[model samples]
Target: MGKNQKKKSNKRFWWVLISVIIIVGVGSSLFFFNFFGIGIDALNNSDTAGSVEQKDLSKKEEEKINQVRSTVGESHQDLGDFVASTHEFYNDTTGYGGINNLDWEEQKNKSEQVIMEIEKLTLDVSDESLKQDLQSILNVSQQAIEEEEAEDVRSLHRYFHDLDIALNDYQSYDRIWNVTETLKEVR
Candidate 1:
């Protein structure tokens, strides 16, 4: 090729390269900053993303809290009824000698139903400690029922005492807490 032609070709190549570089740089910058408001929208939309995510997390946490509250509330209602029923049963059966008779069997069946109801409670609690505490109460109640069925009044009373402690713990776990009523309300 001629020298002038070669020089002109080289100049054109350099101009194209420079122009391409500039275009690419500007386009990439715009895309990264979301100046055109396209794509994921989360890429560079602002700090609202954090806030949005936070709000979502907050909502989920609230839902969990409500669920736990509901379970606890159900527990309270059932436990109150159970306590009353048990006290009445104890009083009624004082002369029966043991809980092995038909009347005691009926009471035992009712207690089992209560246990099942408690088991059916949805426990979506976030706090591990609270969950453990609630589970402890359930365990005690189960043991007490078992002891009562075995016709061991002393053991039943002991288990009931432990259950009472767990119940107290649950009550003191949080003040102004009302779970059963909330569950009723939700339903």
Candidate 2:
């Protein structure tokens, strides 16, 4: 009986040891391969799934894109000029007070004019992304107008920041820099 019990104990110990060794070996191999960046491509199908190559645009498509880009660029420039004029009017102390003392009614009128100009500007592009961005800009502009009407300076500033981001032309560094400058001026 004692011999049988000893044999059973040894068998259990050996089984547990072998199981532990196998587990440790597998875990170590996974860690080693991952650390060395080995077999990672084989294990990960993410690159294949996520990396979609864009097809080359046709002549007509290229023309359309260029037209949209030009329109967006021109519109941005015109709006920027108008905003600068508005800023000048706001900062001017000839008739009113300085930057510290703004005429809310005059500011509201200027914002309304901006909204009107924004409404008049049309994208006429089929690109969903551009259309969405334009819509976001319009929405934020409207919100900013509302904040201006309510005389909420802080909320107006926040909405103006959102409007600047929404107006970002991802292709132009100059546009980004200009937006940054405008934001600094606003502050």
Candidate 3:
């Protein structure tokens, strides 16, 4: 190629490269600013925008809610204690110590006591959903108690699984209640 032709071609390549770079840089900056600027604005305006107004609870309603909370909290604690005790009993019977050391009558009595406590809690619970959950747990525990032999360990495991799920639900409810209470205080 001639020297003049080569110089012209190099100039054209440089121009095209610079043009592409400028286009890409502009596109990137536009995207960055548009996306993040809206995000920051939304964060700043969150309290005012699309906020739900929570009305203050009436005296009677407040008392009822507090009573429900107390009952549920107490029941949750009782269930937790029962679970811990049962777990210890399970570990002692099934661990290296072996099932031979298990006291069947003692286990039966404990199961009866838990069933009685759960029945009372179920009656006291005004929330139908919570009442149903307690009833379900109680039914499962009753089934576990009726099993004739410890050889079928699956029943025991099923009872524990249901108990764990109930405990998690209770904990989640407690956390939600706490968060709402905190928000009320903030307002």
Candidate 4:
């Protein structure tokens, strides 16, 4: 090829590369605060009263449940808020191409499943609420494995499955967190 032709081709290649980098950077960075909201807060809260033990079995378990429950709530809030707002941003920025991506529809189904799990996690108006609550939250955690980003679906599924195994280590239907909930109540 001629020298001038080679120079023009190189310029075009660099321009395309720069454009891709700018688009990806802008897309990924805009969601940083939203993505890490609950994660950062719960880490900061780890040293609070909820982490300590209590004298009574019932109270100690209750406190532990409360701690885990609070963390779960924060995570749900962070993800829910971000997802609810994303459609508006996508509508404004993507000019319909983004709407065509079937990934969003799959994500929508996963989020709905989590919402159903959360619905089950609420109080049952009974005195023995902790048992039901723990069971519900365990189900919710399983649902969360399904709710992960599409890019990591299989990996997350396997990871959370392992988490499930670890949680159920005592040969019971209930889990370590079930015992932990006894602490949260006592605290």
Candidate 5:
């Protein structure tokens, strides 16, 4: 071929090559985005499902409150054991205060944990009224604990007393059910 003719042929070859590359790249990207979209959709669905399962939001808020009550039952058992142990130790040692000063410190720490945990009890459910009620319960418990712990005690009796009342409200099936039933009625 003549020099100009040969140069034109090479230029055409390059154009064809570039066009093929562009077509393939665009096609691949479309496929990738389509598949990626499905993956993202699946992930979102599972995340929502997992939240419901983990929080037991599928059941009414009342049921979740009832579960909290059962947990308090175990906590009561533990508290009773702790009180007995402290008493036994105090009796075994002459002039020993009912429970050492350190016990109070530990309980004070526990008070914060309890307050934060109950406060953060996420009601992902959309019932604003139920959420407010749960917050009220937690607030009362937090206030009682704060007041009780501010006092110095020879024993853990007062601390446990406040804690028991806090748990009592949480464990009351009738009370929680009534509130939840009311909420359901209004909704």
Candidate 6:
């Protein structure tokens, strides 16, 4: 009876040891290969699944940030062109036209289109000052557009001056610099 009991205990010990070794080996391999699902399946916990999901979410967010940054960079370049066109309307005199005789509809339409593009971009900035700066730009831009559409020469000229200043500030803004830094990190 004693011998039989000893043999049964030895068998149980070996079985448990082997099971543990197998589990440890598989877990190690899965971790090495980045197959984290094994942890979730074997452990029956949500930690691994949650972490994987978080990583995927972060990747999506990074992609969105990159897209916005690219669009904003392109838009910034176009902004300079818009300013030039506005300047040209005031400076270049054709044989048929002169200063103060300019039709601003074309420029207004272009500005509105660019504004729509900017509105479509997702700006998830956290800084209060940056947010205010962006708001100022939007406000000034809308005011300028309204004045242009109304053909209010006085207000339009004033708003255009304000828009120019806002745009210049945006060109060297901290938020844009921060975005550039973030792009560097993602790369």
The C-alpha RMSD of each candidate to the native structure, in angstroms, is: 23.0, 18.3, 17.6, 15.5, 21.1, 23.2
Once fitted onto the true fold, the runs of candidate 1 whose alpha carbons sit more than 4 angstroms away are: 1-104, 122-157, 165-187
- Order the candidates by lDDT, highest first: 3, 2, 1, 6, 5, 4
Over 31-135, each residue of candidate 1 has an lDDT whose tens digit, in order, gives 754544333433442222221111222444445445654555345554534444454454354323223232546545655664675565424444444445445
What's the lDDT for all of these models?
A: 0.43, 0.44, 0.48, 0.39, 0.40, 0.41
- Quick one: best lDDT, which candidate? 3
Q: TM-score: which is higher, 1 or 3?
A: 3
Give the candidates in order of TM-score, highest first. Answer: 3, 2, 1, 6, 5, 4
Tell me the lDDT of model 1 at 7: 100
Worst 10 residues of 1 by lDDT: 46-55
Candidate 5 per-residue C-alpha lDDT over 82-186 given as tens digits, one digit per residue, 9 for 90 to 100 = 334433332332122222222444555554554565455433323354345445545544663666532222222222322332234423112211222213331
Best-fitting candidate, scored by TM-score: 3
User: What would the per-residue lDDT of candidate 3 be over residues 106-137, giving only the tens digit for each residue?
Assistant: 65665677678777655545545555555655
State the number of backbone clashes in model 5. 0
- The regions of model 5 sitting more than 4 angstroms off are 38-187
Find the 10 residues in a row with the least total lDDT in model 6: 46-55
Question: What TM-score should be assigned to candidate 6?
Answer: 0.27
Cα error, residue 37 of model 6, in Å, equals: 72
Compose the digit string of candidate 2's lDDT tens values, residues 1-187: 6999999999999999999999999999888766644444434421121122323334554344345445543456654444345434433421121223345676566667756765665444344544444455456556656664322332233333323333333221122111222222222
Return the clash pairs for model 6, or none: none
2 versus 4: better TM-score goes to: 2
Q: Which residue runs does candidate 2 get wrong by more than 4 Å?
A: 1-84, 87-100, 124-137, 149-187
Error of 6 at 8 (Å): 99
Q: Which ten residues in a row have the lowest lDDT in candidate 5?
A: 46-55
